[model samples]
Target chain A: MTQARLMDGTALARRIVEETAKRAADITERTGTAPCLATVLVGEDPASVTYVRMKRNRCRTAGITSRHVPLPADTTTEQLVGTLRELSADPGVHGILLQHPMGPHIDERAAFEAIAPEKDVDGVTFASFATMSFGLPGFVSCTPGGIMRLLDEYGVDPAGRRAVVVGRSAILGKPAGMLLLARDATVTYCHSRTTDLSAAVREADIVVAAVGRPRLIRGQDVKPGAVVIDAGYSPGNVGDVDFDSAVKRASLITPVPGGVGPMTIATLLEQTVDAAARQLGV
Target chain B: MTQARLMDGTALARRIVEETAKRAADITERTGTAPCLATVLVGEDPASVTYVRMKRNRCRTAGITSRHVPLPADTTTEQLVGTLRELSADPGVHGILLQHPMGPHIDERAAFEAIAPEKDVDGVTFASFATMSFGLPGFVSCTPGGIMRLLDEYGVDPAGRRAVVVGRSAILGKPAGMLLLARDATVTYCHSRTTDLSAAVREADIVVAAVGRPRLIRGQDVKPGAVVIDAGYSPGNVGDVDFDSAVKRASLITPVPGGVGPMTIATLLEQTVDAAARQLGV
Candidate 1:
């Protein structure tokens, strides 16, 4: 059998970022103001700091401004909310990003919601979730939005297909499934509480593994000729899907590091520019 | 074969309305303000008129006030939105129900969005949909909320079950599937674009038929011991499910007319009182 084709999200994300950069440049030149993204990190978690740094670097490269708001680990929920509200009201801020796992003490949803819907470029707020679920015009969660861009680039029409989403995070699996369902796919959502995960996976025409469990979806779980998306990256470069074995069965597959990761920041930058264009009336 | 047990939605709805009436009475006696529901009808379609009248009658019997706003068929979208916004701003209006099929000329979504999230007792706003999708505490679309109540009343836990929701309407099928997913059920959504509806329904442990096609789901489509909810009502009192055959194959099934209909109004009144309590600080 021929080897499965790799859905190169890296290349697609690069193209998207390039387009976004052009648009950002046009807006900056026309309006004399660059689109600004406010990165709000509640604590000094190493991983979150690195992620925020990457996003900021991407924003700079895209001709966008990145404003960092680093708070103490013990920041109260009220303080975080107040800070977010200030960012939301700022005329210069086009998008807002709040790093997650904010020490588990702060009310994350409260803080995320404090960001205005127009500025919810990371798409964590309930307002954004609702719009995404309803297929309305608004920003989507970065990762899931990237996943859709990859699927579209590959000409994967979700309509009438059995697409199983193997996780239900608010921004990732849930929104991905909703986007697929909006396109007329028969969408099923499976998670940790699921009784028979393999049974669900085996029936999918497209499988999106996002449970953050390394190699949880083995080759046997993937249907022959199915498309597999590994959105979860556990430690040691392992993905939610056992890529080596799944690649043998799946007709298309996404590699871990080079796939979903780059698309996220790409989508964030793209949306930030879009938000700025709208806000600037360009 | 042993016949499926009937899920008595009428009895359950009666009990719910009785309790809601008691609460409304309590709120009125203490605050001197009865829970008020504003029913806005655009044009006088016979069926929509009947639905609004039924809801108003139910509200009266439950000791809740019903305020009607009737607009002409040629009413502009802005006019309707202005009316809804006015109702949303009115301190006395605790709940707002905009009857469906408000003529094709009107932008239905814009009209629905005009109702404040607090007064959106009919649960049609994007905010309400977002909250319902996130499993957050908020009002839900009446019919789907009623279906959930019936499921809980029957002690049917959706967790770990295969739930296939047939239909993708804004209020009914979409929210029903989301609610089931929130309870940990592996929820699948099937719509008109589904290639083989029977194949999708056959895998379901819980089947919700809401596509408005009479007798679309037959006995062969139902899995043994499955809980079937027929939320569709076609002409001549027919349901989406072929009740005669499905009753023999399924473990639990709802009957037409008496099953899902009464529960919708009951949930409306219950949520109205709840919304009033929150608004009145009682």
Candidate 2:
């Protein structure tokens, strides 16, 4: 049995970070101000804390300034909105990332909308979603943007291809399917409520597993010669796809930790520089 | 062979218009001014002119006022945008409809954006699309809103259903698929570049034909007991689906002239009253 080639998101992310760092330095030199990203965390959930730290570290490594706003767990929707709007209006902040999974009481959409469209480098606003769905020029959700960069890096043309996105989340599966569709792929979105999950996956020329259910996609369900992307990150470092089995049947695959994960932060850093350039008129 | 039951869009549309007229009357009684819809037609295209006239007549029949703005064929994008913005700002104009298929010179998206989101009763704005896709409460594209009403009227639950939308037009097939997806249908979008259109159609439990191609979906491609909706209207009054053949196998189908066409205008009138209600705070 032929094993699939692994799509190395780690190496590509590094390359992107290097390029982004150079752009950031150039902007700092000419504009007399460094590109800055303001990250807002509603509460200190352990995983959320770790994720924010990683992003902030990446920002520092990429020559961008990171501003952290740690809100109390009891913060109300109005308070969160005010804080986000403040960051949005801050001229020194080039980009804004509001780390989500904020408490149940939080109106996530309202908080996301508070981030100005221009400084919304994390790409979570309705304006960004509209642009992404319509294939218009605008900032895209980081994970989906990273996924597209991976597809381009591997020379995978989505035109006339059958791509099944096995999730319907706002940032991941939805935008991933949209980006693929924008490239002329026949995109199918399968969710938890899908009647025949295996049947849908079996028909895919490319499969994107983004539902956060570990091992939801089995190796036997994968079509031979298909490109398999596991954007799902479940507990215990597991992905949505059963990697061992899928590798035997697929042409290309992304391992969770080393694949889609790194690309997300990379894309955020790259877009931060882009947003800075636009705002700086450089 | 069990012939499919026809979904009577004309009858349903009449019912909707009657209800809309009552709402329009209520608004007119409470407020001194009747709700007004501004129909902007840019060019002398026969189809565009016919569509505008239909909308205007529907407005008058529903006891709403109609304002016409006919621009020249050579109207520039900036000029059309300015005119739309003026209508948007007009307190008397509750809804704005820019009859599309405007000549090649006009930038359609730019013109659509000029209409304020609150007054975008036609639901062509990016704001409307984002809300529609996100399943948020907002005015939907008229054709899509009409289709959803039909689905609800017929008690067709989209949950766990396989829906194939055989087009990707921004306002029609795209919004249709998103609407179905919001209802928990596993939606697959097939378009001109789709490699296996027949295979895709055969797998659908619900098929929405909105590609603007006459008789593109054939009987052999439809699964027995499928629900077929023909939203496409080409010249010669033919629909996208081969209705005669598809009806022999499908459980439900929409015909060309009497189906999907009348619903479009009905939806527009209904939404116009809705916009007026919101504006009048009644």
Give the candidate number with the greatest TM-score.
1
- Candidate 2 lDDT for residue B171: 95
Q: What TM-score does chain B get in every candidate?
A: 0.99, 0.98
TM-score of each: 0.98, 0.97
The list of candidate 2 runs beyond 4 A from truth reads: none
* Predictions in order: lDDT: 0.92, 0.93
DockQ computed for model 1 against the true two-chain complex using alpha carbons: 0.83
CAPRI classification of candidate 1:
high
Give, for candidate 1 chain B, the lowest lDDT window spanning 10 residues: B125-134
Model 2, B1-282: lDDT tens digits are 789999999999999999999999999999977999999998889878888888898889999999999999999999999999999998989999999978888999999989998998989998898888889988899998898888888879999999999998889988999999999999999999999999999999999999999999999999999999899999999999999899998998988888888899999999999999999889
DockQ score for candidate 2 = 0.86
Clash count for candidate 2 is 0
